[model samples]
Target: MIKHRFSAFLLSALLLSTGVMAAQPDNVIRPVRGTIDSVKGNAVTITTRQGEKLEVALTNNTKVNSVSEAKISDIKPDSFIGTAAVQQADGSLKALEVHVFDPSLRGSGEGFNPFESADGNVNTMTNGTVGKLVNSHGRTMTVKVKDQQKTVIVPDDVPVVLIAPGSRNLLQPGTKVVLHGAKDDKGQWVVRGISAGKDGLTPPM
Candidate 1:
């Protein structure tokens, strides 16, 4: 009986050391928005809009994309896009900004969720395909995400931009960036994708 108890205790210790008995960390991809403070080798330090500093690691497989200004005419039927909007008093969505995604990024973030803006305002982000366009009270359109649909109005003063493939050279200090990444086992932020502003344009989306 003594020998059997020793064997059971040894097995439990081995499992604990290998993390088999430990709770797994959350690996869900979350957005991090900040301005680059410095770039050294494979790591980038940033100061978040909330004034917290964080260091994010970049792997060779990390994707870097850039956003540039686009016109409202760029949006059409069948376009895949994402927009940040606020709910109006009448139950409609008024667009704060519109971002047209590259074809390769179709269906990215494909749903509605609450978005916290840099200035602390709460908005909604809708990513989907354009179903129809109507020039009613404004540039109103129907956006469909899977089976659900949302009606959004793009006002004349709202910023619209296009997101496309970019190079890592865009990750310069002092530039604004938004990245989606997950924490690794070592508690390091591993970037899956990052979007940087181009030509002094802030990535509004």
Candidate 2:
């Protein structure tokens, strides 16, 4: 009996050390602080506030908040950022998610996008980046994180029925907005959500 109890105790300790606790979050979601030093295919060369310029991972849960769009013109040819983020790395951000908002979406009667998957109904995910919505035509409505006017395309397998429409048309031009999505292998974005705020939107740098 003593040996059996010792073995059980040891197993419990091992599980605890391995982080198998039921209380652990499914995945950690938080905001990170940094700037996009450069944008490549699907990745951004971020210069962290700590003065370290490293290539961080852009995940689906990543949310970029700024007064400016993420275009080359929106940022200075040579700019730095004081990135405020919640990440699980000791170095650059390898984003697992992103989130976006349209500052222009006030009182626009925004629409929503819808898609069906064999798995089941889709719901809001903490890991998604762009606004998954649709236009009045029942067409998927996606905008580039770098340029809201730039419509995004989606793969047939990827559902895009989350974002509410009027993101581009309803919101006033130059409306304050935030875009959410993560970089892909080609450095483009997979948006998950969007929003517009009365404040926190600034023009391009």
Candidate 3:
């Protein structure tokens, strides 16, 4: 009985040590999505779509980028796009941000999963092509990937942006922004990089 107890204790201690070792800081990136409430110098206050307010400090090294405007006509059949959207009660997808991906990145990270949308809810991400498009009453797009398809509603207000270079001056009040931040050892949320959209678009990635 004594030997058995000692062996069990040793096993528990080894497991605990391994867990602590596994938790080493590996440059993890946490996503921050919300609307720009205000900006004072290097500090930015954002009211998340969920109503939670977060303040992030921008350093001189923070990478900033923005999504330019695109028209509904820009979205064509077979054009690859990834939309962060919320499903409506009527079973239709309402787009928050529609990202037009270049042909080089086609079929990348293609699936539906819970996404942290700027509007605060468990949204869905559909990455594929415009298998079908209707624009008479309102715009609707069907995204097809492999054997699956997701129908997304694209309102005129939603911002569409192609991948391009951006600057920090784009971080203005009312601009939708998403950032990847990390908590420092002092428990401060340090923003590593920020991705902002022109007016209404949330960062697609």
Candidate 4:
């Protein structure tokens, strides 16, 4: 009877360990963007451009950065850029926002991946170069990102921005922030890091 009890206990422990590991989040590659509605203690509330409200908990490990305004003319040929775009039915990407990386920041977070878009539609992040540009009808540019090329439509209203190092003090009401984090075991959003734009600058990536 003792041997059977010991076997049962071992099985239970194994199950518990498995559950613990499953509860923890894996690597975070999803992107979160919105306006800071409020900041209270270790929690921050944000309203996305799509009007979805998100309250993410902050931890001591959260990294923060600031962003500044940029111009579309700044994007030259071979200029490395990261943009979050929504795929359209016509097989083109509509630029939600664009981030022009400095020469020193080239190749940072390079690749295409699924992102948490503000509109709740499937979105992707493309990090690459401006292969070609056209002036007819707003702005059309062909971007070579990763191993693929996407024709991006840059509307007149899209905001372009530049990235700069920032601090936690940037987390104030009305500030724009792009968050990257994971959900905890309780299904609560926990921030790993944040990029808050300064003076109305939006974090495009």
Candidate 5:
């Protein structure tokens, strides 16, 4: 049993781990079971019969439907819900999942957001000095990151949400970041997300 001062939901699977006496950062593999105590903007507050309360965060990925595919209503204070709760480092009950008739809030690992779910591995990545974008071809460009002019294959899956220097989104000989959409002949590198410093169009060599 993870020794928690409060009676929040804890994962049964991980409470009994050996060698580790402290509760895992997140071992609640399954969702917590409880009743909806309150409903907030993307998050819902649920309270179990034992007076344990938890707040669950929901995104597009959360499964909020029920087995019958019917939406839950009322969400009575005493209704039963299978829930998974975690005591966050900040000492808050984090609802892993909530089961209700409507089930419009099943935890999809941690809820869902389209922009966030689009690419899990993609983050705001930056290369040193940020190379200048030089138009090598139509709608295609190339530039050396930082200082090295080493030939690096641009990836297509990247999402260049923003470009450095300005919002022109134009790829020119002096453009710091080569933000163009073109695939390599071998079809391996695809330049999608690249950022340049906030200084100017051309990066310092």
Candidate 6:
């Protein structure tokens, strides 16, 4: 059941990353990506990419996941993965980043959905099992989501990473992270899940 819970958390995180907001004004959830400035007790100071400094508090229920650098070779025919991609003129999707999920979290977020990047580019997020791989021209693969499938072209320069369960110990200063949460009544950020970089690797998606 732990894997199921983790999958749910990943789906929630992905939704926040895609800029989805709650209909209720009081329950607005968003994603924040930045570098850690400091950590004190349960509070974390983050320096946003825009040069803004924000302090967020982590609760006992906050989930932590580590993202580490990975290679395209790690993706096999049956590997479950998620990729943010832009649709090309030819109707094929070009990957911006590819993240390989842990085996236990195979079906997390499993489907194609519209996505907007931090820079305002509209894309799509595909999370599913790999059906086939073709290396001609570039690395291309067929991703199956339920009965639906998408063809994604992964460029040689696209970032590839792996996600795994992590802990508070990975919350050190200087690390890059993507936080999914909302602000509380006190106007303080309340973190729900933290996707932290490991070994100097940054969370690409």
Q: State each model's CA lDDT, in order.
A: 0.82, 0.31, 0.73, 0.77, 0.28, 0.82
Instruction: List the lowest-lDDT window of 10 residues for candidate 1.
Output: 20-29
* Local lDDT at 77 for model 3: 85
* Candidate 5 per-residue lDDT over residues 1-205, each given as its tens digit: 4566333444445454421222334422211233454545554454522345544444443322212211222222322222222333553222322232223322222221111011121111112221232322211212222343221222232222221122222322232331212233553223232223233322110
The top-ranked prediction according to TM-score is 6
lDDT of 3 by residue, 69-112 (tens): 67767788899888888888987789987888667667755777
Residue-by-residue lDDT tens digits, candidate 1, 1-205: 9999999888767654642113223322236788899999999998876677889999989999899989998888999999888988987789999999989888877998777555557677889999889965559999998888999999888899998889989999988998877668987778889999988777886
For residue 88, model 5's alpha carbon misses the true position, in angstroms, by 37
- Predicted candidate 2 versus true structure: per-residue lDDT over 40-144, tens digit per residue: 544545443344554544454544322323321221211221111222244222111222323333222222222111122222122112344343332232322
* TM-score of every model versus the real structure: 0.79, 0.23, 0.55, 0.65, 0.22, 0.79
* Span of 10 residues, lowest total lDDT, candidate 3: 20-29
lDDT of 5: 0.28
For candidate 5, what is the TM-score?
A: 0.22
- Model 4 over residues 1-205: C-alpha lDDT tens digits? 9999999887767754642112323232446678999989998999877577788999988877678888877767788888888888999988898888767768767887776555555578778888898866656899887788989998878888876557888899989888877678887889887889888766666
Decide which is better by lDDT, 1 or 4: 1
Candidate 6 lDDT over 29-138, as tens digits, reads 23577899999999999987667788889999998989999988887799999988888998888999999998877787688877655555657778899889987665
Task: Report the candidate with higher lDDT, 2 versus 4.
Answer: 4
**Of the pair 1 and 3, which is ahead by TM-score?**
1
Give the higher-TM-score candidate: 1 or 6: 6
Whichever of 2 and 6 has more lDDT, that candidate is 6
| Pairs that clash in candidate 4 | none
Q: Which model is ahead, 2 or 3, in terms of TM-score?
A: 3
